[model samples]
Target: MRLLILGTGGMANQHAKHFAAIDGVTLVGGVDVDPKRVEAFNTAHNIPNAFPSLDAALAWGEFDAIANVTPDAIHHPTSMAAIAAGKHVFCEKPLATDYAKAMEMTEAAEKAGVVNMVNLTYRNVAQLQRARQIVQSGEIGKVKHVEASYLQSWLVSKAWGDWRTESQWLWRLSKKHGSNGTLGDIGIHILDFAVYGAGSDIDHVFCRLKTFDKAPGNKIGEYDLDANDSFAMTLELENGALGVVHATRWATGHFNELRLRVYGEKGGVEVQHRHDWSKLLVCSGEDAETGTWKEVAVEPVETNYQRFAKAVAQGKTMEPSFRHAANIQKVLDTAVVTEQDRHEHTV
Candidate 1:
């Protein structure tokens, strides 16, 4: 299967690298707004074709699917266009900045009979799958509460080269570019992972989206930095389980840290993935608190690119399908609204 990558940034580059290892998948070309970035990506990744725009790549009609790796703002339009063009799509998370647009994209993809999946990257990890198995198998009994967090320090220091520049992180803080900020970015992952582990959907959310000005002198006169840099939420799951979810890009020492703990009436499990290690620890109710926590082995899971390739080849919709992602979008939508209401009431 031939694929066209729709961006030239970091995630796009990772997609290229991962797809290269898949047996039957080939990355035919790339499309980006910046010609130089496209050229650089092509040169670095050995992609043969680099189109300056999505239309040009779609017109070429040589690829069987699209890897939509564009920014949050562009996710909707690009994925919609690709599905309309009859190409299967593997889109990045947040599906869209707007929930309604995300629903439309999923519906359209289903109507087009295209295999669709979202890059909820943790879903690709074997440890998470093992965690889910523990919960579903009743080793943990009925989940009562869950605590999940995703943290990164990149936004705190603002020293990651061009990443801290106004055109980059500032644009992310802007309402136009990325309204949900850390919540939409990493927070969604926390939600997805927690729900996946509990084997349930989020029933509702009470959330607070907070912005800690990372600018020098803690002020940005130009952009309001309206998007959140951190968030905290209380969630209720469909199966009567309660949860606490938090996400922050300002975590001081943590870089790409994601942690989850699910507590059940009879047992509990904890999964942590960070720069140092990826571990899943479990304990049954019979195991005394003083007893050592058992470390469960994580089996190997296929990468998202490999799974997408196999799903396309087998004519099956991939797990974490567009429909599944839209449910997550709905959860985000509710959180956004609840945050706004809280602000309005405080004002």
Candidate 2:
């Protein structure tokens, strides 16, 4: 499978590295508004072609798929274009800025009969995959409760570099720069972590968002620093589980982490993805009677990059498909409204 990478930002490097490592895939080209970035990305990844726009690339039409690593706002137009042109897409998360646009992209991909997948990132965690399997196998009885969080200390530490001066990090703090704050940034991730680990979908939400003062007068030059720094959502899963999903850049001690705890009548399970490793734990059967949680070993699994390549090769869509992402976006969109109206919103 020949692949093109759209938006040669930081995330593009991961996409390029993983896809290029796949057995049957080749990194054909890259596109970015900044030609220098595109040139650098091509050189770093050893991609042969670089284009200023997807239109130019489409005209050339040499690659079979595109890795849509564009910003959240740009996802709709670029992905719609790719789908319209009959190219498979593996997009970065949030799918789009909102559900309506996400649904449009999802429908377009479905109609085009293309392999469409979103990089929910955490889906690559083997522990998450195994926890979902355990949930499905009914080892946990029925999931009755869940707690999920995505935490980062970038606002409190330089572990991710200074957001004070970096465009990549600053843009995420400014709504004018197309950031929905933490909710838009990693909301989908923790949401997917909880729902997928519990083997259910979100059915309702009551959300609250907070933007702490990060700068003098709340202005860091062009960056507004107004995009929410933190968000909390209380959710009702389709299978009747009640849960809370939250994320924040202000989490002081955490560099970056995603954790989920799922509880059922028979037992409970915990899945965690820290910076470099993942683990799954369970307290079920006889152990559940005594509140003893034991670690369950999980083998490494194929990443979303590999899965997208496989789906493209087989001409079949997989989990976290465009439709599934759109569904998650529906919950996120409602979270925004729920925050404003100060009430629960059904998804």
Candidate 3:
């Protein structure tokens, strides 16, 4: 499979590295708005072609897939362009930042009969997969509640000023880009994991979001600071399971800590921290009586790009398809709506 990467950002670089490492898959080229970044990535990766825009890259028409790793705002347009060019797409998280655009992208891919995958990488973790298996196997019979949290300390430090001090941060902080910041960025991953693990759909959400130190004594350029730094929400799942989601960029001393706990009639499982070496702890009534918890050693799973490539080669549907991605967007949309309503009614 030939692949064209559509950005030179951090996530795009990560995808490029993983795709290049996969056998039988060729990283054809890359495109970025910044000429220097594009040229540098091409030179570093030994890629023969690098274009300044997606339009230029699409003109080449040699790629079988496009990795849309641009910012949240451009994911829709970039993926649509690639789909129009008859290429499968691997879009980054939050899909399109809203339900309608996300549904449109899903429909376009389905109509074109091409594969569409979203990079909700947390689901690929071996421990999380094992947890899902355990949950579905009646070991955790009839899940009742799930609590998930993803936290980062980046925005809690003085260095947060440096990031917001740039005009480039405007796209991420503004709603016109389709998201309200950390919720759309990291919250989507936790939401996807919640839906995937519990094997249920969220029916409604009640959210409380706060900007905390808005403006933060450090204003940069003329961009409006309208994004939330922290958000918490309660999810009512279709299966009568209650779930809570907490995401923040202002958690001091924490760096990418993603933790989940699920309670069921038979047992419960906990994923302590997903971003690094963490174990899946399972505790049943028997184990609780014994005052012990069963620890499952979790081996890290490989990149989803490899899985995507293999699926394409064998003509199989990648688990958590674009439709599944759309479902995740629906939950996120509900959370956003709840947050907005709360904001409007604030005293």
Report the C-alpha displacement of residue 12, candidate 3, in angstroms: 1.3
State each model's CA lDDT, in order.
0.85, 0.92, 0.79
Please give, for residues 200-306, the per-residue lDDT of candidate 2 as tens digits.
99988999999999889898998888999999889999999999888998889989999999999999999988997788999999998899999999888988988
Using all chains and alpha carbons, the TM-scores for the candidates as numbered come to: 0.93, 0.98, 0.91
Which regions of candidate 1 deviate over 4 angstroms? 158-166, 216-222, 288-291, 343-347
Model 2: lDDT of residue 300: 89
Query: lDDT value for candidate 1?
Result: 0.85
* Per-residue accuracy of model 1 over 1-347 as CA lDDT, tens digit each: 99999998988888999998888888899999999999999999889999989999989999999999998879899898999999999998878887789899999999999999998989877888999998999887888999999988887665454445556666667676556688787777888999998888888788898887666764465665667888899888888998899988778888788989999988888999986678999888668365557898877898778889999999898888888888888888788888877731110
For model 1, how many clashes? 0
lDDT of 2: 0.92
User: Worst lDDT window (10 residues) for model 1?
Assistant: 338-347
Write down the lDDT that model 3 would get.
0.79
lDDT, candidate 2, at 149: 92
Question: Cα miss at 87, model 1 (Å)?
Answer: 0.6
Better candidate number, 1 or 3, judged by lDDT: 1
Clash totals for all candidate models: 0, 0, 0
> Least lDDT summed over 10 consecutive residues: which range in candidate 2?
159-168
Instruction: Output the TM-score of candidate 2.
Output: 0.98
